[model samples]
Target chain A: MQIRDILSFSMHAATANRGRTLLMLLAMAIGVSSVVVLISLGDSARIYVIDQFSSLGTNLLIVLPGRSETTGGPPPLLGETPRDLTLEDAISLTRARTVRRIAPIIAGSAPVSVHNLEREMLVLGSTSEIFDIRHLDLSQGNFLPPGDPTRAEAICVIGLTGKKELFGNQPAIGRWLRIGDRRFRVIGILASPEVSLGEDLGDMVIIPVAAAQSLFNASSLFRILVEATSPEGMEQTRQSILETIRARHEGEDDITVITQDAILATFDRIFKALTLSVAGIAAISLVVAGIMIMNVMLVAISNRKTEIGLLKALGASKGQIMQLFLTESTILSSIGAAIGLVLALLGIRLAAFLFPQFPLYIAPWSPAIALAVALITGIIFGILPARRAASLEPALSLARR
Target chain B: MIHLQHIERIFLVGDEEVHALSDVSMTASDGEYIAIMGPSGSGKSSLLNIIGLLDRPDNGSYELDGIKVSELDEQQQAEIRRHKIGFVFQFFHLVPRLTAFDNIALPLMLSGIKQEERQVRVTAALAAFGLSNRAGHRPDQLSGGQRQRVAIARATIMQPSVILADEPTGNLDRSSGIEVAEILEELNRQGITLIMVTHDPDLGRRARRQILMVDGRIEHDK
Candidate 1:
């Protein structure tokens, strides 16, 4: 028979049994929609994390004082403490060719008293280079001046929150605030930006690294942020920082150098695996839908034996008979897949509306994959019933009432 | 032309083998009007089915128009059946969901004929069968004689050389039955070979040649 003729026959047969066809279509649509929606959820989570990390910084390398081996396990938080990273080590890293600038950090909490008002706040100690490296904007006065690394000038920059609490609309610049029994001049007040990565940028105070070391009575630095001039130099700059720190700490590689790209790559791999696993779990429903197609088709074949027998007597070949039934299933799956894609889009929209923070959207290839899988399962499950119908004896089938 | 030699068919009905056709031999030239008549279980319908290529005889050397059809494969037999033979059944066997026009167009459609030509031929066939006004009605809406006319139109749409009918008017009233019998006779008069299986003696006598089957064998041929 011609393809058009077979298609028409198959379509008429499907429409003749509307209830069964609709039931099969519903099963297939639900299966495909689950796959698309679940995969979309996983993809949205990955994009959200990547966006948050991007907001943190670019071409950044973090140097910590302790070393931990990464051997398919979590990094050891309290691993070997070989040697301390001091101001001298951070100073030596600045001499490397790939390094652009460095911010040696010393973090501690102290109470600030301006006359009768006193408030305890976190104090971050770094150099003037930290202003450019961390993309901080100054709302008033100047940042700490460039000077000798050991000079402990009693000057500081307060965040907008600190300025509001201690000074309370009073001029904060050039005001003397007592920190740990030492007086410091507040030279700059920081402008607050939106909260990113859950760290409030407006609640901290900044001072010179040398002054913080004296105030806290500690010679060791907490962490060093190294900024590479360009992304291409990030790996080279990380190696140079590690070597510079290792040479100063008695030939022991006691620091971990992590680039932003390395963290992003790790997160990318983890999210990709998560997406695949959930999509695989959702594919189980598609298999069940295919089985339902088989069951319905088998019943249809039995019910239409007389029609099949009539066709055979009119000189239809066995292959033609099989093709007619297979065409019916292919049509069903195509319609079901289309409906599923629309439903998945609606589902993603509903989720996004409910939780505005979640970045939910369907991926590009998910619809294509869903459609291909639906077609394959429909054809595979349809084979047994089609073959059974084709194998019927024309004489015997016609003999039946 | 048609020829059959020592055709044998057996059925295993629970542990006992019933011989549906045993050592039956027959031949007829082109355009011959032949009737096969017998009581139930005498294998008249079985013989008609075998002649129509609906069933393969266990043992036979059957030839049609000099082709060894009994040894042909399923597909080749189907090809021959499509172009060389047609069938009229007792139930009319019109696909109930299709309109009368589509019922007449089925055989041509099955043979991969184009829709435009199929349309012209179906229109002509409908007018010839006196069913032009009933073209849009389904089989259930048509009268018994009209349904049989639609079946005959479907059977002859391929313009086959032979028509094998099994009690073509078995379900019709007396007048409708007579009308259906007249149509089959008219097709036979047009030089298409006709082989009919019937139990009615009066109907059997209307044929140019009669074969009486008894106990799975040809008891008489006249």
Candidate 2:
């Protein structure tokens, strides 16, 4: 038979039973859409995290007390306590020429009250250097005054949400708020939210490191932020900070210092595998859809026995009969794949609308791979039924009603 | 010409071997109108199937138009059937999903005829069969006579040299049955060999010649 003839004939056969054909189409469509949507989900998650990480800062370094996973070997001395990441250690790191600026951090949740309107939120302590190294956006008043790193100032900066809660459109720069047990004047209100690792900048407080240490009643710094003089000096500054810390902490390197790219690479690798796995899981549904097609085809063959036998009696070769059946499934899957692609796009569009900050879009190869898989699956699963139909003896098949 | 020699067909029905045809040999020349008459289980269907090349003879050699078609492979036999033979079954085996026009065009499509030629030929067949008005109706919508007419139209659309009709009028009323019989005779008059299988005495009397089968063997040829 001509190719077009076979295709149209198969299309007619497929549409003969509307309910059955629609069920098979829906099965195939669900399988395809799930694969595309799940893969997009994983990929978008990976991209969002990478975007947030890259937006952190340029030539940035984070130092935490004690050994973190993937950083160094076990502590050199057994049964000996490692020293804390202290303010003095942060001050001493500035002695290196490759170091551009430093922000000593001491973070803890504490309630700050202004005229009895108070709620507990994250309180961050740092210096004026944090304003640039952390890419902080300030909407009002200046950040912390740059002064001696050891001086404890009675001043603080509130985030946008915190500012609203405590001041309510009232002047806040000169108001005094109580943090822990100390009274500190509101120095500035931080800007709207920025990508700051895991914390929401819109709902936190910022203060000087000494004031935070005095409020928390602790000498240990939560972490330290070090900015290199230039991109090329990143490694040099890292080495200098390490050497200086080891010399000060009795020649024992017990701190964890990490770069932005290292964490980003780790996250990228994890999400790539995750995306592939979810897509793999979704492909199983395609296999199931193919099986459903096979079952439906089997039923169709049984119902159309006389029709098949008549074709044989009319001199249709086995190969031609097989072509007709396969053509039907191919058309089915092609339509299903096209429908699924439109659905995935609409789903992604909805996601993009819901979360505008996250870049959610279709990957170029996903639809191509999905479509190829669906077509091949339809054909492969069609083989058994088509072969059965072709192998039927014309005499016996025609005997059926 | 159609020729069969020493044709035998065996069936395993519940592990008891029954010979549907045993050593059946026959021949009919071009444009011959022959009917095989027999009681139930008398092997008329088996003989028709072998003659149509729809079944393989367990032991025999059959020739058509001077070619040993029994020795041909399945594909080669199908090729011969496509261009030289046509079939009209008792049930009118028109595909239920297709309209009468599409059903008539089936054989032409199988032979890969161009669309314009197929359309023209099918249109001519519809008009000749007096079914132009029913061309768009599916088999279910067609009456017994109309369906049989569509089947005959489909069988002849390939313009084959021979027509095999198996109880072609068995499903129609008396008037429609005579109508179908007249149509088959008309095709036979046009020099297409017509071989029919029928047990009805009245229907069998209309044939130019008759063969009687008994117990898987030809009992008489007259």
Candidate 3:
């Protein structure tokens, strides 16, 4: 039989009962769209996270006071260590040649009141070099004055949210701000609505590291940010920071030195596994849809036995009979998948519009994958019914038995 | 020419074995119109099915136009059926999903005939069957006679040498039956060998030759 003939006849047969064909298409469409949407959501989350880390620069390394035991995969989610990571230890890391820039951080929460607009919010203490190391953009005014790490300067930088809440529409730069019994002048407003490490930078305030340590009456540091001279030197920089800290702590390794890629890789693995899990759940629907198609096709064969018999009497070969039946299923599945793909892309587009920061996107290959899988499953399930139709006895079928 | 020798066929209905056709031998030459008449379950339909290559005889030697068809493979037999044989069933057996034109053009399409040629031939067949106005009508939309006319058009679309028809007028009224019989007789007059199985004695009497079957055996050929 001609391929076109097989296709046209199958199209007619498949669409003959509009209700049954619609049901098959609806079931397959639901399965396919679910796979595309859910997988895209998972994939988008990974992209969002990795994008965050990359902005921190590939040569960056994070030094925390506590060591998270690395038993191969991701380290256990743990907290502060017994050993203290002091600003002195952070300063000492400059001894290594691989460490090109260091920005020591001391984090704490304090009540900041400006003109009775009192709010308890997070405060980050760091050196002037933090602007370059963390890629913080200054919207107005100048950044912190560079020079001494122990200067206890009272000047600070406020985030967009803090600036909005405290000063309303008024100018925030060069304004005095009160935090934890000490008064400081706002030197700059950090721009670009950034969120890092689960903390909205827009909701936090930053001051000189020494002023923060004195205000909190604490000598231990929160964590240190180190930027290597080049991306390739990050590993060596990690080892140098670890060694420098261990020597300072009586030859004990208590601090965890995590490279930027290490954190990015961890997030990458987590979201990939998440994507796979959701794809698996969605694939169950595809399987159920396939089985439903098989059931419907079996009924169709039973219902059209007379036609099958007639075709055989008209000299249709077994292969032609099989082709007719298979083509019906293939057409249904392909059209269903195409519809699902369009729906998913539109849904992702709408979702991206709804939650612009969610990074809603569908991978180019995901639609193709969904389509290919649907087609394969349709053909696979079609075989049994096609085979049944092909093998039907012409005489018995003609007798309508 | 069509020939059969000592054909035997049996069917197992649960635990009971029924001889559908047994020790039957028959022969008919080109352009010879013959009718097979018998009561229900007397193997008339079985004999026709065997002759049409739809059912295999257990022990028989069959030849069509001098080819040893009974010894041929299923594919070869199907090729012979496609190019040399036509079958018309009692129910008209037209595909309800297809229009008369598509139904008649089915054989042509299966033979991989081009679209333009199929159109021309199907158009000619519709006109020849007095169904030119009904070419676009589906089986359900056509009357009993019209459906049978469409079936005959489809069956002979490939211009096979022999037409095997089982109860061609069984589903029609008297006038429609006469009309259908004339169409088949007209085809036979055009030198196509016509073999028909029928329950209507009147239709049987009109054929040039007749075979009477009883109890899984041919009683006589007159």
Candidate 4:
């Protein structure tokens, strides 16, 4: 048959049962749209996690101590630790040529008061190098300078949250704050850190490392923070640092090193699995759609028995009959796929607008895959009806009416 | 030219054997106008179907244009039907979905004729049958007479050597039936062999040769 004739036949067949055709198209669109929306959401989740992790400083690594495993063999935890890193170790690491900067940190919760305004805040006591390691920016005044390592200087650098709580609508820099019966001068206010994974690092205060050590009764040990010169050299620097630290501690592999890239990879694996699971669920609906297509085609064949016989008697070959039915199925599914893709795009945009934090991004390969799936479904579901129509005997069919 | 010798067609209906055609022998020369008349279940339609290549005789030597068609495969038979034979049914089975023009153009299309030539020939055929004004109308839109004219136009559009019409006017009124018979007779005058099966003796008597069938066998021939 000519291409024009085939198309005309398909259009007539579709219009013959408009309600059924529309319903089938709607079902197919739903299936394809779900796949698009789910995949986009999965992509968005991955991007959100990666963005949150990168905001924490790409060149930094976190070191924790312990090797505890849950009874059910849960994944290993990296940050739960009882032993503290020593100031001597921190100093040695800072002096090393491979290490660009280091900081020994001590953390505690304390009540801070400024002009009758008071609130409990997380306080971090660390050396001046902590600002450089964390890429901290000063918004109001100068950071703590390394001086008088033993005696406590009555100076501190408050974060944006600490400043707001201690002196609301009032100048905080150069003001004095009381912490645990000790008076401290507000030397600087740090800029707000990037909000990541719902955690805000701008809700704390910074003080001198020596003063923190004395106040917390932590004399020799501290939490060591290290930063590499470049992200490219992070893995190599981590290996060397591990080796150095191991050798220095008599071959004790008690410290754990976690790289930013490694954490991102783990997150990628998690979201990839999530995407596949969602796609699999959507595929179930496609199977149902295929069955529906087969049923509709079969009904069409039975309804047009006399028509088929008339064509056959008029010299239509079996192949032509098969092609006609197959074309109908192809047209149905291709249109459904196109509509589904549009619906999916709309769904993504709506979801992003409703929840800005939960980004929904569509991948380029998604539409191509959807079209391929639709065509395959059409062919698979169309075969039975095509064969049935082809097998109909012209003589028997002419006698039908 | 068509010839059938010692043809036998058997049917199995739930363990009972029924002979639709038995020991049937006949010959139709080129340009010959013949009619086979019989009562219902007299094997008139079955014989026409076998001669048209729409059915295979169980045991027979069937020849069309002197080629042994009974020995040919299904594809070969279909090819012969496409190129050498035409069929017109009692119901004027014009496709309900297509216009009268498309119905007449169908045979030329099956033969793979060029589109421009097919349109020219189909237009001429419709005009010759006084269906030019109704060419664009579907079967449901046309009257019974106009529909039969379209069927006749389609049957002769390929200029086939032979036309097998089964009760061509069984569904038409008297004047329309006379018009259809006249059209077939006119085509036969142009040297196309026309074989028709009908129950009306008056229509059967109009043919150059009339054969009477009973119990799957020819009872009389003239």
TM-score of chain A of each: 0.86, 0.86, 0.92, 0.86
Model 1, range A105-204, lDDT digits (tens) per residue?
9998899888988888888888998888878888999998887868899998988888898999889888899887999999998886446676566777
lDDT of 2: 0.90
- Models 1 onward score TM values of 0.90, 0.89, 0.93, 0.88
What class would a CAPRI assessor give candidate 4's docking?
Answer: acceptable
Displacement of the residue B170 alpha carbon in candidate 1, Å? 1.6
**Candidate 2 clash pair list:** none
Ranking by lDDT: 3, 2, 1, 4
Better model by lDDT: candidate 1 vs candidate 4: 1
Interface RMSD of each: 0.9, 0.8, 1.3, 2.1
Candidate 2 TM-score versus the reference: 0.89
Number of clashes recorded per candidate: 0, 0, 0, 1
lDDT of 3 by residue, B148-183 (tens): 999899889999999999999988999999999999
Best TM-score among the predictions, by candidate number = 3
| Overall local distance difference test of candidate 4 | 0.82
lDDT of 4 by residue, A296-355 (tens): 889888888877877777677788778888889878887888899999999888877898
Q: What is the lDDT of residue B151 in candidate 3?
A: 89
Tens-place lDDT digits, model 3, residues A1-401:
78888889999999999999999998899899999998999999889888977887658999988767643655437853468899899899988999888999999999998989988879999998898988889888888888889899999999888899999999988889899999999989989768886878888899999999998999889999999999889888888888888889987778888888887889999999999999999999999999989999999999999889878888888988998999999899888898889889999999999998777789878988898988998899899999999999888899883
* Candidate 3 local distance difference test against the native: 0.90
Q: Rate the local accuracy (lDDT) of all candidates.
A: 0.89, 0.90, 0.90, 0.82
